[model samples]
Target chain A: MTRNTRLLMSMIFWAFIIYLFLPLIMMVMMGFKDSEFIGFPIRSWTFKWYQVAINDMEVLGIFAYSMTIAISTTILSLIIGTWAAMALGPTKFRGKFILFALACLPAVIPGIISAISLRIYAQSLDITPGMWAIILGHTVHNVPFVTLVGIARLNSQPESHIDAALDLGADNVIAFMRITLPFLVPSLIGAGIFCMLTSFDDFVRSFFLGGYEPTLPVYIFSQLRTGMSPEINAISAIILLITAALGLSAERLMRRNKKKV
Target chain B: MQTNDSTVRLQNISKKFGSVVAVEDFDIFIEPGQFVTLLGPSGCGKSTTLRILGGFIEPTEGEVFLGDDKVTKIPPNRRNVNMVFQDYALFPHMTVSENIAFGLEMKGQNKAQIKKRIDELLEFMQLDGFGDRKPDELSGGQRQRVALARALAPDPKVLLLDEPLGALDAKLRKQVQIELKTIQQQTGKTFVFVTHDQEEALTMSDRILVMNEGRLEQDGSPKDLYYHPETTFVAGFIGETNMLSCSVKKIDDDYVVLDWQGNELRGVCRSGTAKEGQDVSAAIRPESISCSAKKPGNKGVMKAKIIHRVFKGSFTSLSLEVDGVKDCILNATLAGALAEQLGDEEVWISLDPDYLSVLLR
Candidate 1:
């Protein structure tokens, strides 16, 4: 790349980094503000909001609800998505292209469409739009992301290694567990973290299907309507910190795996 | 019948992938403790047959025997065979020691025994002090040695190698091929090696199974295949040959009258059938054809013009244009007598019928 192009790209990259991290940084700063209103450029610092966030029963309930849904969505997405990817990735089958295309379509489509369509479908089945419905919506959205991660991982694996493993004296199941699964661990972990983070931070899908129990995103949305509070800022700060940690660890795990390869 | 101490038997084995037949009616007998190579061009059934023995694929129609047991239905891991893959196929994530210990681990051997065998194999393969490194961390030759150590670490009844040296460069390939043979001999394990390179096959194998188009063209010792190829494919594949399309005129007990390019002459028949007026193809190796500047009238001399000479280190190969066979070119290697240039000069060619392998279809 030319120097001009490199300079332009570097500027754009840092600009995007600033744009993504600025809001979280501001929210964290606002969480420490002593003033009643959680705003930018705080006049002083205090720990009252952090204290309130830890003790508030309603906020704790919302956090617990989101955590439960995110975990469930992550686990379910990984199980079904990994199964789908392995079925379609390595082996040859009729209509394989069509099956793969359909499997990947949900992640690209807008979440509102999936959530609203799932809400209608669930209502028709006489299912109350609750934790289950929200989970279903998040799973529908997360499956494609998980499947893509899984397929890429599986594709990167040289099929010869598995064949060689089998030739060496491993049965089908044993070969898969010994050779294939160990290689896939990094991608599976990465996909699981992504699924959980998406489900946790999700607002549209949770807002559409979450009926009785409010997810943290929907709770944050409700808190937004009541004007910003330092407790909300403190909670956002905690959620951001947790997601950032997951993102970093997942990235590090995949990088370590790549280094081995 | 266990007639020849055959450790592995493939009977009329055939494999098809959709419309393409990868291996067809391939029959091979691998003797116990023998180093046999399946030599062929790519797309031939050598590797496929190896896979069948490794139990990686089920033949479309055939049976495979390991000792007295039929292993056609057995899965690869369940079979008593191990393979050193073309790319080595060492697990990237595992250290060299761990990679070698994999098969033993599958056998449920305890850590102490696995470690002991791993060390022994590493030492035997000359890979000591390198167990902690992963496959990527090692050089190509090191990786190859590690792969061999891993395959041998399991103490398999049969060791199958599919183009084991194909990934290495020329120098490393020769060194490793000798190492592989020595290891096989020391271990006294049955080795079924596959390679497309005929020279390597000739050097390494006790018996070479030459294949073409998914068919076993010929199976014999390197000397036997080199001197007595059974088919046109084997003659052209296993060694260099100058094929001349000739027709038989009369067959006798000792020799036969052959019509080559409208020139009637006498040639020896090595084996099989030859009838009067039967069309046949004959092969002569370059070294078999004796070239002379002056015409020798009496024996088996055919007229030829010297087209060009290529000096190949120890020998010079002369490309000659024969009379009445416009497109037919004969390659003759000349030593002391006919080594000098006889520019565009017509020379007499004498081919001993005893040395010529007549391939009859």
Candidate 2:
């Protein structure tokens, strides 16, 4: 309300912003430091760590492995979560709230708890700690975000569009495919990227159910156990760049979709 | 037996949501090329009945017939009916041309046929050169016409419109109502329109079915419903009314004498149950009440004080208080300028006996 309070608020907000970005800035700066150890007085700067991160075959393989798992998790979660969302969207059934709660319960539980339960469940089903197991765990965690975003988008859709499609002689499947799915594409893409990015960087579940070959996050954790190096910082900075790009595109698309709708 | 020449037949339709009845025992047979309106207030089962006809809603108990075939169990896609939703319901993803082509494509029409029909409809709805535009690109009225074009593209047996003009401004709504009626007649398609607006129903529909509380109150022509409503709900819901609660003093062959606040007023016996000493309401329209400064010589006349005068452009509505009655306010709508004529505080009121129909419950 007053000038002093406004000044204080501005000071606090800038401090919080700096507090959040300072570590990331430091980590990215440390990647360019020309020392074996990552104390960041960069007496010399070189692109050699970035070159190593790009050229190392093992790191390349793990990055690709993480990408493949994220893609699979995104696909599976989109299908299952969109189904859950549609189920929760238009129906007036008695158990609809219960169904929605169950669909979103995984997102509320601790990631460690979800990982341990998934590991135990996989073991009970005679499944091995492999890529399939890791993908399954990631999908379970990612689906709730898809479902939440999908339901919200679906709610914004007019119920009459589907009805008009039906009145125009489209069957249920055709109506959904033509009218509802196209309407949901923006949210689906946004939610899909969200799912993929979360799955890619996830460590707890991947650590529990990962195969002999490590995903990038699991491999990074392994590298941390061995030692701290600028190589790891370079890999993380690259991953951050990719995530930023994807997140920005997703946000832009959702904003554009909002304007269109 | 299925009736001949009837385009739609809703047989003993009843819909219940859990324990609440939405439409009860509603039966109507619509002839071909007729513009019928299910007219009522909101939540009064008009939309529910229309949805039943379009097969969007399944009545808990009913059999629907389109022409000679029964379509009660059929879905909306299989039924030979199309609906223009209240919100226009145009697909936001599709262009106008694509939206119009959707129904035709579903009918398995060839590409050429679909294109030809789309052009024809765009022209018919006066939306030429606007086919490629998306719904958001168009104005409210243009979007409504586009919705009409899309619904008409399929050439269904019956076209259902659920308050499609409700979203437009008042002037646009009147323009669209006339355009829609003209389009229906030109195409000779059966139109089952639904609206809570009585004026719209009167202006467009050949037949209006007035519903109240899940029951059909009255079904007749616009003039018939306006002049000769069978129930009080129809009278009050259709237009402004001066419901003079009176008792039947005497009933003759052609006229019934109702004693209204100690005044004997003659009115047409609408429902034929005007017995002696029975309570009834004289449903009098304000336009039917003639007002003059000089006392009228009519037998059932009222000398009233002018309470309030609201001057409309075409006519003036004056609220009058009857002498010797504490709260008996009678409204009179007189044509032309009456400000110069009625300079006195006291006014004479005379009811047109023909328009003053006695409604008996």
Top candidate (lDDT): 2
Off by over 4 Å in 2: A255-260, B1-6, B292-302, B323-326, B337-339
- On DockQ, the candidate that comes out on top is 2
Q: Write the per-residue lDDT of candidate 2 for residues B194-253, one digit (tens) a residue.
A: 999999999999999999999999989999899877789998998888888899999877
lDDT of 2 at B281: 84
lDDT of 1 by residue, B1-361 (tens): 4533239999889999999999999887777889999999999988999999998899999999888889899988788888989889899888999899888988889999998998888888788899999888999999988988888877888889999898899998888888888888888889999999998998899999888899888888999888777788888886788887888988877777788887665665555778888888887788988877777776767888888888777778899887887678889888734576454568888887777776675
Weakest 10 consecutive residues of candidate 1 chain A by summed lDDT? A252-261
Task: Look at candidate 2 and give me any clashing residue pairs.
Answer: none
Cα error, residue A50 of model 1, in Å, equals: 5.5
Q: Which ten residues in a row have the lowest lDDT in candidate 1 chain B?
A: B336-345
Runs in model 1 deviating more than 4 A are: A1-34, A38-61, A95-102, A105-109, A116-133, A211-213, A241-245, A248-261, B1-6, B262-271, B293-298, B302-305, B322-325, B336-348
DockQ of each: 0.64, 0.86
**What's model 1's lDDT at A30?**
89
